[model samples]
Target: MKDKKQLFLSFLMIVVLALMLPMSALGAPGNDAPPDPAYAKWGRIAVQEVKAKYPEDKVVDYLHVGRKTNNQETIETFKLWLEGETKEFGVIIDIHFDTDTEKITNIQFKETSR
Candidate 1:
């Protein structure tokens, strides 16, 4: 009976620690709440930052920002600024929309070749 009790306690401790591991690993020491994604500042920042690298007209498609089609609530499968003729934008920039604000978190150049 004593062995069984010890084994059960060990298993419970293992399970508890397993649950805690993810939480601890996922967060920084002082962080309590997850970041907010929907802030307007987020989207504005993406456009402003990417604009420095490419012209606004060069920006073909990005969520959170206004779309040519004027549609909202879309992700991934959308219009993308691409190489028209000059290969100027050979790689389409992927703009990540913040989950909380529906704003762009950042922009990254796609690795796939045009």
Candidate 2:
């Protein structure tokens, strides 16, 4: 009877201790793994433009060149490296959007031969 009571008390203490711990300590989301950074709207648009223009090539790497604002317009630039069967090239994509409407104004892709 004494052993049974001791076992019951031990189990109760463990439960209390567990409840006092933080939810993350119990293996909640983002505890052991971090979420990936999301792409901006302009970034997605630039990638799609590159894919459409260079269907024969695959994008190997990319770099976001940041955004520039001029009065009522904003431009997002990205440098994307593409690989083809026998050549590798870099493309500079400029995505221009309206600041007030958040709509695309123009997209230009310039290829840099390697």
Model 1: runs farther than 4 Å from truth? Answer: 1-37, 64-85, 88-114
Task: Name model 2 segments beyond 4 Å from true.
Answer: 1-27, 30-39
State model 2's lDDT: 0.80
Clashing pairs in 2: none
Error of 2 at 114 (Å): 6.1
Position 88, candidate 2: lDDT:
72
- Report the C-alpha lDDT of model 1 over 1-114, residue by residue, as the tens digit: 686467558767877897998787777776665556543454555556556655633554344434221244323222244323354343344455544466644466552333
Instruction: For residues 1-114, write the lDDT of model 2, one tens digit per residue.
Output: 686467558767877786777555747655654344433667777888999999999886678988889999988889998878787789999988898998888988889974
Clashing pairs counted in every model? 4, 0
lDDT of 2 at 86: 80
Q: Report per-prediction Cα RMSD to one decimal.
A: 19.0, 18.5
| Local error of candidate 1 at residue 9 (angstroms) | 67
Give the range where candidate 2 is weakest over 10 consecutive residues by summed lDDT: 30-39
